[model samples]
Target: MERITERYRLAVRALGKFHELASRDTLNEIERDALIQRFEFSFELIWKCAKELLYVQDGIDAASPKKVIRACRETGLLSDAETEQALKMVDDRNLTTYTYDEAFVASLIGSFPEYDAVMHSWLEKLK
Candidate 1:
């Protein structure tokens, strides 16, 4: 529970940074990469928050990613499409972290706005 709270705080901080970066007009590749990484990390924290909420409220098992995400949808913490996108971002983030390929990173950078929209909407729900 403490960990979940810490994660939520961290995610909120990361989202603040994301907003700061987004406000800038121009970013170099490295800057964009940093922002993308932070964005991905924030999404992971959102997932954790949803899972912890479900676990606390419904006593659902949170060990399995699939189960946690399903519980999130069932509990109205996330929509079906949002859960799917978050899972995809998790997978893509893993690949980007391990592979270090420019093309894929570019693709990820291009997709950042969509992810940001999803995250912002989720955050709004929290508010």
Candidate 2:
């Protein structure tokens, strides 16, 4: 549906911004925080888009990020490995609330590149 398509496009664009920030060689504390925030929003948009597409295209009505991601795997939108990674990504997204913890931020930011790659691949399938 047009709504799903529009949401997919928006999620893709947000992921693009996340990819840009995540690809940085070094970010100051502020930039690192920005990256974390970007990841949070990007993850949110991507999962919601997935939820919408699953509902419209596949008759699934996943109510949360993890559910949407799991449904994605069951529906062949994600491989088992990708599903595992995405589930971990969801954890990372949840942990973003702890951005004040320097160690946690560093660890989470390190995972962004992989998240970006997986998200891009999944978005392509949605497209």
Off by over 4 Å in 2: none
Worst 10 residues of 1 by lDDT: 118-127
Model 2 scores what on Cα lDDT? 0.87
Question: Considering only N, C-alpha and C atoms within 3 Å, which residue pairs clash in candidate 1?
Answer: none
lDDT of 1 by residue, 1-127 (tens): 7776776787788887886776567799878877877876777777677667677768886875557666767777668788787677777777876887778876876777777777776655543
Winning candidate number (TM-score): 2
Listed per model in order, the count of residue pairs whose N, CA or C atoms clash below 3 Å is 0, 0
For model 2, residues 59-109, the per-residue Cα lDDT tens digits are: 999999999999999999999988998999998887777546868877887
Q: Give per-residue lDDT, candidate 2, residue 69.
A: 97
> Which model scores highest in lDDT?
2
The TM-score between candidate 1 and the true structure equals 0.80
TM per prediction: 0.80, 0.95
> Please, what is the whole-model Cα lDDT of each candidate in the order they appear?
0.72, 0.87
Error of 1 at 35 (Å): 1.1
